[model samples]
Target chain A: MKGILRSLLTVIKNTFIRSITVLYPYDRIIIPYNSRGSIRLVVDLDTKEIICDGCGECVNACPLKLISVEKVSHDKKIKNFYVDISRCLFCGLCEEACKKDALKMNFNYELAERDFSALRHDIDKLTEYAKPKVKEFWKS
Target chain B: MENRKIKDYEEIEGYDIYIEPQFRPFGFPVGLYIALKDGVIINIKPEFGYLTTGVEKVVEGMEIDKAIPFIDRVDSSSAISPELTYCIGLEKTFKIDVPLRAKFIRTALCELSRISSHLLWLTRLANVLGINNALHYCLREREEVLHLIELATGSRLTPNFIRVGGVASNLSPRFIEEFRKFFRSFRKNFNMLKTFFLENELVVNRLNNLGVLIEEDAKNLAITGPNLRALGIKKDVRIDDTYGIYDEISFKIPVGEKGDSLDRCIVRMGEIEQSTSIISQAFYKMPEGEIRTYTEDINQFSGNTRSHIECPHGELAMEISIDEGKITKLRIKSPSYNNLLAFSRAVLGESVEDVEVILTSFDICVCEVDK
Candidate 1:
């Protein structure tokens, strides 16, 4: 009975002393330094330039064929390189194939879409979504 | 051992016969221990099917290009490796060779991903063990690595930037300079991780000699990755099988002394150092070349092909059967699948509290296991 009491005390001490569990979302714990969150692509719209050739290379590169690149041409040259984010693998292939470096992967991870159509992002929307900003992380 | 058995009693028959307790009289992570009364475990289980998604089956019927996201979702923790492996497999099957510059960048980013994943795992491990400071420290460093990947590759987690025959494009001069700065930081953080993970008293206490799997056990089960390397065996798919520009850069395959949890951690930590070395070397000697593999004639194998890589997680193997260059059937084999075996061996005889750490030490991904 004495030994049992000692063990119970030890357990209680551990439970109380450890400040391990975080009240997430409210507390919003820091993700590890190298965490892989969500797939993001960057479009430098400040230059008003699209990086994707929209040749559908990423569309072809995907093992699933989920990507749909609908290219809009104004002049003889390309105008808009639209993409279906819903179908995109977020595999970074589009960014990989974006030889112009017009397509980059940004760290903005939260994309909880309400519907499939909402999941889709055209070139214009993608450009708007490509702003670079590191999310605030708590040290403690 | 002696055992005692009582004859069925009339008093217990109508009382609903409480065969098993309904409420788990323990922690959040419960251990399921089922065994024969003859001192043998019929089954030792953890109610660990929560983090499950049919990622593999999701990708099977989809086109090669469409399945990338589903593949990344397999293990949110280390999703990039799976996606990258699949892309490499496609490139090989399609007979596309990327440019020289693209190859260097892929090598750099892939190594960066490796460091990132390791840091995450280490932090998670620390979290479970009540080592808050260690967890925070590791998480901080891991963020920097992710930022570098984002700076270079664009996305923090799901950067599907590595295309077939080449990377989407090359880093700009400014970004390249910043990336070189990241290269130094990666090396510095990796060294810190090595020292902390390998030498920290609490980490050492929690990990070392806690689990034991000898060579024969690992061999019989065909376990791969850091777990296998922990047994002091060097069987990396990158070196042995040869994939990407891994053949180009000089990197060492770090191994450990024992097939214990500590050994596994040590191997992973040492691999981080090796990965860091590979990165710096690749960065400095990053030759001017294509980041992708180009294909002239897409009409190639017209059948099934298997490609393997020594990913940070383990020997990540991918199986894809193509009919006229469109991926028909895709199956993935991750290192976590083999490493899951270490659980029953590691957890048995130990108290239930150690289950989480042991589960973590193996780094078992439920998605990978189910897939």
Candidate 2:
């Protein structure tokens, strides 16, 4: 019985602490480094060209089959890449299967779409989601 | 009692009370039908399968890697347990040894998931019992655990982090630091929970000796995990079967004198402390190594293997057969499936008012049972 009274007092005391609620839109959490928010294409640093050779590996590797890569050149270079974000599971299988590491799961999580067609994006919109990788180091 | 004609009592079965399949607490659709005689529940039947996703049939002939996402989706609350079981089955079939780092990570995640799942159970119970402030406190603490999970695996509920031979990635040092902080503070919160809820006279009177399951009955019905342990039966998958570095760790399993509703609740409270210790030990002994071994051939083995784990609810088992890079057959036996049977048997002869208290005490996951 005394323990219960002590607990009640503790609860009442703790209620005076400032609320930890973050006001959304005014305050937001810093997204982590390896968060699988959205899928994007990785561009090569040396050459001003896309790294994917349009081999359709991501298309085949995708469990949901939400990806399709089209070729416009005779050399099988990727011209247009379509991704149905609605059907994507964000499992990172496609990124793992990519031979050239051209595909990556990015950290941009604000993916609300007003229309269904807006969820289906081509190469340009997908590439725009990619941001520079944040350097992560383990605390010593 | 039999000769008395009660109000609204049908001629066929004394008083046939039916509850339609509705969305119940804990976000699962379930229904209950009971026959009461003189305010005592005489007959009870639980209805389920309202949210079947046909997950088992959908994963047929799926590639080994692709089927994991579906496996992880089997139970959102206990996602890591099913995924870990699936990966263990596949790894056993392929004759691959999981690294020490991966094993430690899996153990830590499994323990954290247990803590969070129990918190969810308590949250729903607190809300049902009108302990609104306790509900918020439980959710607040549970949110801390979920945040730690999100920081580690990038997603809160469905991590999909466990790979076949290892984890999907390495854990950052920040996760360890945060986990230590949470671990230190969780004990005080849990003690308060015990004092406020478990030791309360009203709660004890409501829960004590309401739904009793005998030791023989528990074993005969194949009840497992904490539910079985609540009957004073020393049967745990982690201890009896031994998996995921649990054999290396030293932790005591809590058992109750009589398997009543209150006993079950107390046993779970005991388990939360045990899981915290397990996680701390696993984190301390964690070694530095590769997170995953990129196996080119994951489906080289064709034989079927069954993997079982001591999930938060109870024992969860999975059987997977791989043939040439694809899963030919898959079967899952979740703890809730067995606990539901035990629930039906235990709830008999209890007062009608104690139905919800008895039901929540079992910690039955409708998604796992229905799936």
Candidate 3:
């Protein structure tokens, strides 16, 4: 009988507490600065150039073999780089293996799309999602 | 043993009751075949493993670096175990000593994962028992743990943070401070949760003595983790194997008297407290140093090594045979594979309606077994 009353009282106390449910698409919560969401190319801070030299380190580093890099020039400069985000585990190995630090896992997580074609991101699409390093945000 | 009795289905009359593979419990696909005699279960022929990824086949012939991510994918709920186990195996095979700071960080992350997994199990058990408030509270707590994980590892669910020699990144001062705040309030919050569930009459009445697993049976059936611990066994892989810096830390292994469903749930609850304390201790004693030591060339490595990690579920052991730095053969023994066998025996003589509740209490994840 005491246990029942205690449980009832606990429930009554909890009823007035704030709800933890996040109303997605209406109100947004800040993801942590280090949160890994989507893989993207990095930009050199000084040069303002997309840092990828068409080197295929990421292509080799990818666990699922989802990344493909094509060389189109005599200097072995990259012509096309494709990442099938649909098949990506988002493990961030490609970002870590980039010798030039030219790849990063960005914080923009809203990647859901209706069409499967939209999920396969090319180099241009991947570069557009790139932003400054998370260290800059950490300072603020 | 005096009270144990296997009911005969031939004598009892009732509606032909059988929940097929389609209408399974826990909203997951599992073949939990049970025969009910007058609303009571007469026999259970458990058929698990619907979703098999064949990770062993995938890892063979793959480079050691690439295989860590796939190894982490084996059990999503406890993602760190297989990754850590595989890395530890590589380190042992190649003769590499990990840094002290890295060992502390690995232990902290593992304890955090255990807490998060237990919270998830608590929510599932509460939902199965029709306790809405407990579900909300457990989910709320779990979200906080996930945020802490995200702060340290960049990803919340599948971090793949631990590498061969050390963790991927060092612990930031901000994360350490936020973790202190979390640690301060955790005990209080967990106590309230315990009071609501462990002491609640409804939960006790429904869960107590439902599926009793004797200690002898648990050992003979190859049961591990909280399921085996609930049967009054003081055997924990952390203490027995003394892996990592676990030999340096001080924590109690909570053991149960009767191996019932309620005991299983309580044992997990006790473990959450122990894991929290262990994390706090690991943080306090953490030294300032490099997180990782650069290993020598990978291509020249050769050896066959086996590693065991105390996962949230149980001991996850992995054997890797490396030839010229390439994985030639791999074998994984997940705890869920053995726990499912014990689950098949535990669910016998239980009613049809209470099947989901009993199963969740043991915290047997079907995907882990299938992996």
Candidate 4:
């Protein structure tokens, strides 16, 4: 009988407390800056150009071989870069292996798609969502 | 009466046999075969192999550094323990020295994971017990711990934070501040939870004296963790085998006198308190230094080593054999596999209604079992 009263008191006290739930679609919680989200190509702040030199360090660093890099010539010019997000683990190995600060994991987590083909992100798709002026938290 | 066959098992005249197929609420596909007599359980046979990803086979021949992500998924709820065990095995084999700051951060993260894992168990137990309010409260506290992990490791469930020699990154200042805030309020909140759930008449009446496991039977079945501890055995991998900085940290191993379902719940609640104290101690004694040590050449190292740690479930150990940078063999001794055997034994002679209660009390992770 005492235990029942205590539990009832707790339930009553909880009624006055504010709810911690964030109603999704109506309101969104702020994601942390360093969260491992979708992969994106980092662009130079002034030049506005993708900073990848086509060195393929990220390709070697990736354990799953989801990243593919192509170079046009020996002058460090990138021809095509692609990332298959279908099976990406998002371990941030590619971002850590980039010596040129050209690759990063941005804070865009909403990557749901209806079609399977749209999941494969190319250089244009990667750069399309790239934030130019966002401070790099992983570097620190 | 003539003998008959049901689902490949011989059915006797006086007993009833049924197979409980995997359900959605159980979170994993682990079928249970129960043999009943007079509404009491005569036997229980657990089935596995429904969710096997063959993690050990896939990790073979891969570099030691590259296997962290794969290992982190073995037990996704408390991912840090397996990752830490794998890193410790490689570090011991290669004789690599981890920085002190990294060690402190690792210990803190481990305790945090333990707290979160236990809270998850509590949520499941509450759900099984039909206490919806307790489930909500447990989930709320678990979300706080997961958020802290996300703030530090960039991911919540699978942090993949621990590396071979040290951790991947240092603790941020915001994380430290939030941890302090969490530590301050968690004590009061947990007290409220205890009053709301553990001390309730419904939970006490339902769980007390149910599914009692004897110490001798538990030892025979090789049951570790709170289940064994509930039988008054003071056995813990963290204490017995002093891994990481556990020798430096001071914490009590909570044990229960009776090996009943309620005793298991009480022991885990005590453990949550001890884990919180451990995190605070690690935070206080944490030193400022490098988080990782750069190894010049890891491929030239070749040896075999084993490392073990006390996970939230029980003892989790990893055995690794490396041949000049490539892993030749990797074996994970998960606690849930042994706990499943113990569960099959503990469920005997109990009524059918208490089966879920006893199962959740053991807190068996089928993913770990099938891994």
The best candidate by TM-score is 4
Q: What is the TM-score of chain B in candidate 3?
A: 0.93
lDDT of 2 by residue, B1-371 (tens): 65543422453354377665664644667777788887878788777888788889999988877888888888878788899888887777577888889899999988999999999988888877777778888999899988888888878888878887898888998988888899888898788788767777777777888899877778788888888888887888887888879989999999997999888888999998998999999988988887778787555657778888888988888888777777888888988988888888898888776778788889888889888
Query: What is the alpha-carbon interface RMSD for each candidate?
Result: 11.3, 2.1, 1.3, 1.1
What's the TM for model 2? Answer: 0.91
lDDT of 3 by residue, B145-229 (tens): 9999989998888887988789899989999999989888788778879877878887888888888876666778787888889
Candidate 1 Cα misplacement greater than 4 A, ranges: A1-140, B1-43, B46-52, B185-196, B293-301
Cα-based lDDT at residue B155, candidate 3? 80
Question: What's the DockQ for every one of the candidates?
Answer: 0.13, 0.38, 0.60, 0.60
Question: What TM-score, computed on C-alpha atoms, does each candidate reach?
Answer: 0.69, 0.91, 0.91, 0.95
True contacts kept of 2: 0.46
Ranking by TM-score: 4, 3, 2, 1
Model-by-model lDDT, in order? Answer: 0.64, 0.83, 0.82, 0.86
lDDT of 3 by residue, A16-124 (tens): 9787677999988878787877877776668766767787888888888898887777764567778898988888888888888777788888998999999998877
Per-residue alpha-carbon lDDT of model 1 for B272-324, expressed as tens digits?
A: 78887887788787777445455655544466777777676678888888776
**Residues forming the 10-long window of minimal summed lDDT in candidate 1 chain A:** A31-40
Candidate 4 per-residue lDDT, tens place, B220-337, comes to: 8787888899989999988888877989999999999889898999999999999999999998999999999989798788998998888999988888899999899999999999
What clash count goes with each model? Answer: 60, 0, 0, 0
Q: What is the interface RMSD of candidate 3, in Å?
A: 1.3
Please give the lDDT score at residue B31 for candidate 4: 71
